[model samples]
Target: MAIQKNVLRVADLPQKKPTQFDIQPEAAQLDQITDQLELSALRKVRFKGVVAPIGQRDWELTAHLGATVVQPCVVTLAPVTTRIEEDISRLYLRELPEISEGSEIEMNTDDTVEALPATLNLDDILIEALALALPLYPKADDAALTQAAFTKPGEKAMTDDDARPFAGLASLRDKLNKDSDGSA
Candidate 1:
């Protein structure tokens, strides 16, 4: 059976009770999440969490999320595998803070707090959290950028330092000083 994306209904949540959820995305769902995250590949994704009411209209949600992903190395373009684990927490409010056009909304930035919608979409949250946890630059353990051997048709290959414009500036300065001394 295909996994349902959104499962939690905030309205039906019992007062003073905590609800637990454990979700493991199937192959198809993992593919969808991988596409959404723009990852090279996703081997697995799992989330285990609990949601409990804290106040009359407020709730606290906490989850332990884990995922295995594959990304391209930034320098070598090789596939790099990564395992991600995160302890996620959020506070849901029944009433969202009002904001008008061109108005500033004040919010507490310390915690992941948001307005509670009619239903909570765990799939969406899982995708978002995984994307955030992914490394911006992934590189294989042994991948390193060696000196380039790129050269135009007949030109000699240039080393990395040779490609820099100022690499020979000190030598030029020394030759100029020697020439000046000889002329004197």
Candidate 2:
């Protein structure tokens, strides 16, 4: 079925049939998404999924998200392009456990469960999935950090070897043995 609107009311859905939906944002929408995500560019973003009723008063959303995105390299600032594909699932329950503000409580181990909302926003779901799938650090193929050394003029610089206390003691013992042998 053609999903004309981005938002759908949960109560209006068919009781026994699954609703298929596809989301392919326009150029302007893509630009907004790129700006929101801080991505250099986004192309060919698509979300295809089905929403079906579970047991009484529960619903499940299963979807596949695919997109091509470009991001700045973490080290060299070069553009790194990535193709992302993810399988997303969410369970909406009519009755969700409540948590008080500022209260320390054990988190539910199931991350896919959510309180049932009067309306489901597909755009929000797509954005959230994309954000979660993005790479924490992007790097170009030739990006590498070079080692640097610094020391004050006329002062000895501490190297990795000099940082070892045991190594310094061993060198001191060898020097003492050599001096004694020469004196004898």
Which candidate ranks first by TM-score, i.e. highest? 2
lDDT of 2 by residue, 1-52 (tens): 2223589799999989999999999988888889989999999999999999
Q: Rate the local accuracy (lDDT) of all candidates.
A: 0.86, 0.92
Report the Cα lDDT for residue 39, model 2: 97
RMSD of 1: 3.5
Backbone clashes (count) for model 1: 0
> Candidate 1: global Cα-lDDT?
0.86
TM-score of each: 0.75, 0.78
- As for candidate 2, its clashing pairs are none
True-vs-predicted CA distance for residue 117, candidate 1, Å? 2.1
- Superposition TM-score, candidate 2 onto the true structure: 0.78
lDDT of 1 at 22: 90
Q: Which stretches of candidate 1 lie over 4 Å from their true place?
A: 1-3, 95-108, 149-151, 156-159, 162-184
Candidate 1's residue-wise lDDT over 77-153, tens digit each?
A: 89999999999998898886777899777765765988887888887788778888999999999988776697799
